[model samples]
Target: MSDLYLSMGRKEGAAGSLYWAIQFTNTATTACALRGYPGVSALDTSHHQIGPAATHSGSSYGTVTLAPAHSASAIARTTNGPVGGPCLRTGSYLRIYPPGSRSAALVPAPWKTCSGIFQVGPVNVDGTF
Candidate 1:
């Protein structure tokens, strides 16, 4: 599995958010899922790029399953919120794996993550690895 990070620009005075899209090539024979709905991350500039806002959801998007040998994509749109997690939106982050391959930590914490510095979720977040 792999991770990608994006730094977005808000529409002036609009709350900053995370908008992501994942494109993957099917390498496994079995069906797979591009997981990411309702993802949660607390406010920690040192750890997470996008900080928690008074109104955020778990994940911005998710794809239940993908056909084998087929290429697909998913999008996530994140925002700042109180509790729980982000909700499904146009853009989102996705992590894909073969049937039941999700382990304790499918994806690692982005080593070079973003800082809660800007309004668009985070500014110049580099920890997409």
Candidate 2:
């Protein structure tokens, strides 16, 4: 995990749901493989988790082998709560645990979610999703 760089790609939305591409780039000299869904959660200003961790979505858990400088990505989806609603909260950042890794990476993601119920897809080769 130390050899991987994590970042957000772009914001996408449909209906009332929000999506973000969680990008993982191989920064090592050799290749690495990432499979399954990454662990994701929203964090507040104090770095405390807002709610339960993201649930896994989809079954496309194929191994994504990334060579140096290559990238893989996972899609995270969540729904925003009504303004001033009881379930609404603004997350200042996100805590991401790469597949098969115990270490976590943090990325800035100021977004709102209803109870932090995020759905994340498995990692796939770049441009495949």
- Whole-model lDDT values for every prediction: 0.32, 0.83
User: Where does candidate 1 have its weakest 10-residue lDDT segment?
Assistant: 118-127
lDDT tens readout by residue for model 1, 42-86: 223333333332122222333545466655433334343322443
Work out candidate 1's RMSD over C-alphas: 11.1
lDDT of 1 at 47: 36
User: Which candidate's lDDT is highest?
Assistant: 2
Off by over 4 Å in 1: 1-18, 33-50, 53-64, 78-129
Weakest ten-residue segment in model 2 by summed lDDT: 79-88
Question: Compared with the true structure, what per-residue lDDT tens digits does model 2 show for residues 32-102?
Answer: 99988899998998999887788988656788899999999998887755533356478889899999999
- Give the CA lDDT, 0 to 100, for residue 60 in model 2: 64
| Model 2 TM | 0.88
